[model samples]
Target chain A: MESAIPLHLETPRTRHKRVPDDYQPPYPSFVARYKPSVNRVVMAYFGLQYRGTAAAAATDALAEIAARFAAEGGPSHWDRAQYVDQAGYENVVSVAYWDDIARFDKWFASAREAWTGAQPEGIGTFIEVLRPTVARHETLFSSLGRPEGVAAISGGMSGEVQEHAYWGGMRDRIPLSQTGPMSPGGNPELIRDGARLRVKAHDNLCLIRSGQDWSDTETSERKLYLDDVEPVLREGMDFLRDDGLGIGCYANRYMRVLAAGGDASEKSYGQSWWKSLAALERWAESHPSHVRIFGAAMKYLSTLGPSAKLRLYHEVTVAAADEQFFEYLNCHAKTGMLAAVETVAA
Target chain B: MESAIPLHLETPRTRHKRVPDDYQPPYPSFVARYKPSVNRVVMAYFGLQYRGTAAAAATDALAEIAARFAAEGGPSHWDRAQYVDQAGYENVVSVAYWDDIARFDKWFASAREAWTGAQPEGIGTFIEVLRPTVARHETLFSSLGRPEGVAAISGGMSGEVQEHAYWGGMRDRIPLSQTGPMSPGGNPELIRDGARLRVKAHDNLCLIRSGQDWSDTETSERKLYLDDVEPVLREGMDFLRDDGLGIGCYANRYMRVLAAGGDASEKSYGQSWWKSLAALERWAESHPSHVRIFGAAMKYLSTLGPSAKLRLYHEVTVAAADEQFFEYLNCHAKTGMLAAVETVAA
Candidate 1:
């Protein structure tokens, strides 16, 4: 609170240039180093228009890319629920990722090019790049291994304020243990089963351990320093998990924080990977208890103060590939005399 | 699926300027005519550092705006949830809608200024914009109030594809007929007691009238086209609602269906928006269901995919204004400035 601690960096401007590995404390404990892992992430959002019969071809190509990525245990990918604008035109958010920029480039070039090449026509990709910065990550509830546990396996998404009230009720309605258990060790298991509960349970097992704010009467409407907020949040997360109620994702005193001026780090925002939409649907359809609690939570949100809000954005994995083929794809695809010669050579 | 319809327009390159409202659809539909009636929604996401104190101020301001809009029977507003980012930071998204663009602009200007002015010393705002084009849009579910019966009113979220699976599964688990009926002229007398059940019921009871996909069969996967896919989606959605499930969201599929390209849209990549960190936190505390769903979704995503392949970005919204505001406040401000300070006749 006191003049807001000067964050480690004014803003996450250059932080995302080289994707970080893991969360680091960025702060020092009582005479010790507490560096949080800083993962570098780069995102390029594209708006494209293609020729006839290309949309399906492109999407299928993307799906293939995703399937391949899944097989390789790579960054997840998928097609957002398809949507259209007023002109009867359709579009999507092509999403892809990479731990290493070089690898990403490889995937971008090779796999992406192959997919595009298969298209009946060319695509008009967005001119401007799209990226955002991220900070203070937390995982609230998760489970794995069960039919309903798939939801828990994936990481939580960047939240919108409008939906908070609904989730608030949900936290109260569902007992944590029922959803899943807390991870006693550092490495929580991933969901191999069909359900999201398996993942949810494991996620609950792993406490936020950092970054959080608790809901206490005294702290109501009060500003908290990250130092103050983190410990309290950690304790509360542990308590929730210990009590068998899933840990929650919350930032007390919503609406009062700000990013360091001039900060520009590419952040992550969007849906996660699923074996298929079918896989996701099955988990939801079969899980009645989870659904009940989830419903009650939503109803409660509607009754809360007008402090929440909602926004939806779709991300489609327009192009993607693995490390091996990128070089020959994006980097080597040249137009002109050389391209002509290469085509003839092929 | 016979050579799908050509949905994209080959506009001149110069016209590709992506103005704020540049995404206007050339065609006409409910979204074109009725979108204005329904509030224009925005979801703002912020990182953890910003969520400390600055975010709260911004969220408070947003809540005030949402209330004002709701008072006018305008569109709804709220912040959905906080998500864990690869960059090792926590991010929150806020959702809000306004009746008229003018009102929204007024609120946005006021909020923006207030946010900047009240920004914590070190913390700044990181924001991004994600507007769905035809190629990438997801409107999986939609529900309306039955005549007078209200089946249910729940709070839910739809994450970007990169984060995790869909968050709507929460809705699937709720009991059917929890509230009264649908809307626009159904049986309003069913749950007249104003009890939770009565309130839960939809007014015009058009439960899941339609969806994007019909069945989850592999066979359906083969015919993935607007023409081929639309019918199944419609049927599936109808079944959900008619079978007691609520409608998701009336999607703008026409554009997506039209743009039959090999890939999806550009908005699929990383994108976010939020005033301050604190504001994001308040939203999280208030909305726990989102936390649970988001957390579960994220964890599930971690194992199913490779963390190394992902990329994230964070951006800040310095001066965001809509068209109505450009005409109202901006123009008026300029006019006022030009007003002849006329030699005060001094």
Candidate 2:
């Protein structure tokens, strides 16, 4: 594995996170581990939107979809929750994870046919899916718990990793980033026919899901979070949502993770799309918004020390154009990847 | 106003929306008309966030700020609303409009001194302001009532505008876009000292605040919106928030407008930041998410005919680097323009 390149060689740009020779992380963090045989994973979001009057119909639709997933040849792991969207519409979203794209492909065919075949009136249904290779994905968690998102399908969590608790740590965690800078290539293109729209993604399109869980915090810690930290976090999220183009963020959503009964839970997360891993890294490392977030988080963690019950985690993926699939049926023009690409008549 | 350029001349790219010579709008839409003497205006968002326990403190703070505005030198008009942010924290936001920046400057000095001097414990405060020249701003409305945002500072609504019901109409509506392609010219730079961070913005950074109001909708129209249009709109907004990089959107927020008592009102909006007007136009003209939004709106409007009560409006501004100012005090790293630029030690 030895290379001819010298250790002292300095390139104009570095592909990996640079820390001072004596730099050490303030706290230990863990990275999700996957089996060597697992090369690609599929993350799919099945969303169903309904009005209050159509609750029964929406429930029936969701039940049918759940039944299919429970049948043979389904995803390896799946979770569902209910929430109210920004427009105050009731929505039930099911997230499914599959370690093997082939198995997902097999299950998706039947699921798509059954779901699209029966179009329930007064309900909005959509499927947004992504398949990223192992090298293109990265994950970090502050503490161990039942892993969420892509981690649910992972083999286990790694012991404390050395790459975290500092700027550029996220990029340094991504395996692909070690070999080359994941720069975006080409542009997203959309094909439309009638009510259906499909968006073809571009190379190195980056997606990040940064989450927080104060559901298990003590009363004092909860107050500290609600009073001191959460407001700062919301400010950052709002900034990203309203004015985040100059630094390379495309879109951002600060979503409340809802309970099964559709009540706002103690958990929430920010989902964002970036032009490339570099753009995201730039913002995280140097943007004032991120700096403020880091400062507040550090202060909070230090104040509570080991007794801090609040949990934080994130997953970032840079998907190749061919690895992404975005389609909408009877959905709005701004759904998912549709807003990032040009649409043309099929 | 006559120029050497011929009418039939076709440039490499067009700065305005293009429609067939015989094209007629499906429905009439109006643009806000500013007084001839008014060449610029300032929009400021004064926000106060507090926990439930600090409601009284927040109220007092709001009263103090409002009192200042009501005094001798102040904004031309102002409106207030209370809403819950994504983090479940209560926020009271006051939007003030000033036709003159110098007048705002005069008021802001005292306001800043008074507001910042008193750091009310347990309450988080911030100010986000934008000043754009008349040529750099544009506004449109399906039907006007008490106009919101920048329109609140305008003279009145124009008669049925020619640019409506067509792709690229937004660009055509912008007075500056008629002459020049509003492209970004520089990168955002930041300077930080302790808890304070200041961001210098780039040229032609586009800002859009697109709003929807169904507050006065009849039962049937309200149902039509909730059942059909709203879901689609949420999908589009979510798309922009979660995945809007490839088409040039930097950030997008789908926010619910709240009542005076912090209850959700029958109004919402999508506020987004884009790299340039051209990028925005491209998305509006051909992106699937926007296409779906336009389709749904047209269907709703046509279905309800002239009796439709759902109101829609948007304001777009392409600000020069010097025209924009971003500053944060004891704020998180990801606040406002902070997320869109680099931060350096002051």
Candidate 3:
């Protein structure tokens, strides 16, 4: 659920505020901190609410059944949390992740039955149902706050700082960067040396990108182009990484493969946490090696196809971090909140 | 991606799969192990390939710009992953996470201009035109391998000692416990005192009861009937925690509220993870407390005017430990995964 709340004031500020006669707010409970093991599995749940009193009944029944099942012999080694709201109106998105697909599959089937069975008459009213979509990727970098000495840097080399100027403006902050090609000048200096952790998961991206045809393969000539594509593709990826451009740094170069049907369906995304936006922006604006490699890669791709049907998006994550990063990992599962600090400050 | 991969190949097989000479296999160097962090944000790109050469060109340009931008100082921190096949086609899903949103946001803006500005004329020729949708949600939970003990208990759970089970009969090696309700006596001995991670995440349930109603308020006449509700809800939650019937023993709940007008239309979701289908189940079978609470909740909700809307969902999680959990967490921004280890090295 997107967050917002109106806490009771010691003094009433708004005249329209109306407190329910029996309103009893749940007390704030302190959550315990716990470090997660590396082999853990996490799940997020997204749900769409049914309209009317029936929807309430549906949710309550679901809650009861779930609680009972847990008491019976369900796994208790993980954390669980939820959010409900009427804010989004007709659309209600419920998302939850599981430690493993196997266990998740079991929980999924049983839960479906319980929910449907509970409201024999009202369960079929859901609109816009979507199947599960999964994507896996790796983390290359992260930045949670402005790094030291960024302001002292000259030009736009402030890396993520520049990126933020553009993206934040789009999100209703302030307009600084215009919507167009970025002029080269400002570029943040890369850490000449530092300990950067790199992690990779199995087939997350490949599985999602499989079967997307950027070039027409319906003809033999188009298919032959594939032969020369491998080396170029590798070079391009290598350049992207070696240059430290980070993913999604470009506005118009977005690429997506069409789903099996002729529609363009894509996979989920990976998370990031750079040390600073200035650092991020510098990589985006001034990387020279990436410029050359990516350009060559594009030229090669154009040989098989033309430029159409493509779109691009740009976002600046001024402050960034993995949702399941160390700080997140230490949060209490039950409350969807941070736990009391033992090793780190809350 | 709903899982369809077979689980029979537990032991690694020879890596001898052949690919067409023209096949552009993704670079293996791009793959890495996953790390868990609490503060990470991902910037992902989804491109539709069906848009043809023009789309490819636009995407190429964006890629080039992104690469060049990286050269500036973005800290090479992006991973291009997930190419999903909807129907029979494919689409690309690239992701990168950051430690801070501000830094990412800055780079994101500049990149946006580069991408949008580079679009070729008549770009719509390659594919259908649809604005891409970007969504952000917090991480919840994740797991790997049969949630804690499902793997160990696979022997009794599966006479043939199969590993995993798919939903219904769709996939191979999946188990029923992970799929649906287990028979009361399925594994009495295995239902020990400690937490047993299951094969699934959330459990969705319906609260069933005879008779129904349309009430406007909890009038004085029904005060006694309402008096018994709170106990039931507490009982259910307590039972799940104490008795160990639910998956991922930890539990939490949230409430959802709509923000009056157009703002509500932009984003949608229910409160907490309970909004999903799986968590709802735990609330049901966990205990009698849930049943009582549900009855009360329904009655109370029914009094929120004739038009009050309510929905239900339940979920249970099976978490993993160590590398497995870390893999799960690093994969998503909002979800947290705890590893599943040998609770007792029996």
Candidate 4:
């Protein structure tokens, strides 16, 4: 069934920048394209929050999880990062990706048992898992050499895709967008156990991880980025964090990526949850903050031409309600998905 | 009616570093000490969270609030900062201070009406107002020149305070700590009004803002800080953010201070809410993460001696329930104090 949602037609209300049908992107950009056999992928975030005294214990717990993942049947790939949350607690997070749900379920069940069975005092643990169908997930990258986020699990890059370099290009690239408008349905529900809180997901809950890496830029470009582009980008990010609720943003976190040694790196990303893909698109396509961001980025890119070493990329997912799981132990109610859910008796 | 909480006595289970009565600090530090006539101070945080499209409207609203405060009998001092929240929304926050509650109430009533009466579309507004008795607030600074947070409204800085350079010094500096054990007594209760939610404060809710400024440091010292000190400091901060619930911390946010032009500055701070001053003290004195941070800081200080240009400061307040007011409009359930409260009908 063909939905009434317009496709690539600019109306009087259109505010986003659009390219003509024959327009070509100035630079090559790539998106992840998985194999046909990979019908879906599971992304799981295992988090450890702890006080200084529990550092050793938390580290040990993380190592155990890693070991479990490295077993006979486990996630295909995983990465770790560290950050401090709003409440001033330190967090170590490990993100694992699996192309198959059966494998993920087996590994997760064992890992969960080991993690919750013997959590040491002064440590809080949480798991946020998302299983999005292959058609529902989309990824874009400015460069081809580096693959981050869900792109790490892709079979290969879709060498120079035609959908980018214009507004609504992100939606056009998503396979599921062709079939239907991914409108949100149902409200988030919460269940409480002892010291743990679990949030059941709602359909069409959108998640996006948009990132920037200026670590490889030269002195002038780096200065230009830090002084010009970054400020505008930050302003946009700050706006979304503080007041995007009216536009259907559930929550936003602007985070700095930590290096292997737990030091803050030159890279950073904004991770946000939205009510639906349409809401996110509404903000991105026409929002003034994004326009400023786009202007700054275009100016920087044009000034530097192909020599610009800065990298930009994003991964977006819209998960089905049955394919998501969020559980938090001894954490404040605002942690992750808990913030958007209504608490009910278990 | 003397409380049984021990004062400066080292028992067999002592874990925190202590200084002898005659021991002298190697460097000078200052604390804010208001005049005897000023028995209390009011601090109000007015926040504007908005999407890019609503930026202009939000800015105007903020200006109106400032203008209202500037008019006939407003706050004594006020400052502004911009940040991104967990949900990816951008936030512009204005913090105002008043020496008299009567003056604050008078200004707030007018300001509240102007704010809530006509909030533009695509914007979310919130007010977190706190009034603490003079005896309930304490401030400490490593350097004498720069005054921040509550110190911006202090009569003057206390010259060479002796309560610092020890683990339990923070508690010792609070005047109210002398008479009673400031134990948390009540649960946070929430009241709803249409889209707005108000969280009534509990009895001894603790708030702390600990800041670090390495803006003026030389290359070598800055490297020393970023490499040696910051990693250790961040580890402690992360631990607290993730797992401090078992230790009495309610919430923690490690934030980068934005410059006047909305650019990230060379300063950052960890703002946290705790159950009580005693809970905070226990973590500071006995937590391993904090111990590591203290060691790193001491090493850096000893190495740099008097040449260290990094400035450190913190302000802590143990607020009475009646003195606190938290109200969020069109905000997620987890924003600020709402995360730790129980919701009830209006």
lDDT on C-alpha atoms for all candidate structures: 0.25, 0.70, 0.25, 0.74
In the order shown, the chain A TM-scores of the predictions are 0.30, 0.86, 0.25, 0.86
TM-score of 3: 0.18
lDDT of 3 by residue, B34-100 (tens): 1222122332332222234455664664366447446643523432321212222223322233444
Per-residue alpha-carbon lDDT of model 2 for B1-346, expressed as tens digits? 1111212222443232333233345467787787777878987777676789988888898888888889877888876665454455666667788998888888898787565444567676667677888778878888866587788879687777766554456655666655575667766677764455666667898888888889889889999999999998988887765567555676566777766665678888777777777677656633557656656675677688988988889888888877776655543343345546554323
- Write down the TM-score for model 4: 0.46
lDDT of 4 by residue, A1-346 (tens): 1111123321232121122234355468888767767878988888788878888988788888888878977888877776666667777777788998888887778788676544888888888888988777788889878787777887677667666755456765666665555678877778877667788768988988898989999899999999999999988887776676766676666777777665788888887778788678767744556655766786788789889999999998888888788888866555677767754324
lDDT of 3 at B160: 19
Q: After superposition, how far is residue A295 of candidate 1 from its true place, in Å?
A: 20
Task: List each model's interface RMSD.
Answer: 16.2, 19.1, 29.2, 26.8
Docking class of 1: incorrect
Error of 2 at B40 (Å): 50
Q: Per-residue lDDT of A31-116 in model 1, one digit per residue for the tens?
A: 10112232323343222333455676556654555565565434433222222322233434343433334444555555444443
Candidate 2 or 1, higher lDDT: 2
Per-prediction share of native contacts kept: 0.06, 0.00, 0.00, 0.00
Error of 2 at A304 (Å): 1.2
Cα RMSD, model 2: 18.3
Local accuracy of candidate 1 as per-residue lDDT tens digits, B164-257: 1223211211212112111122211212221111111112212111112212223323233223433433333233222211112211111111
State the DockQ of every prediction. 0.03, 0.01, 0.01, 0.01
- Among the numbered candidates, top DockQ falls to 1
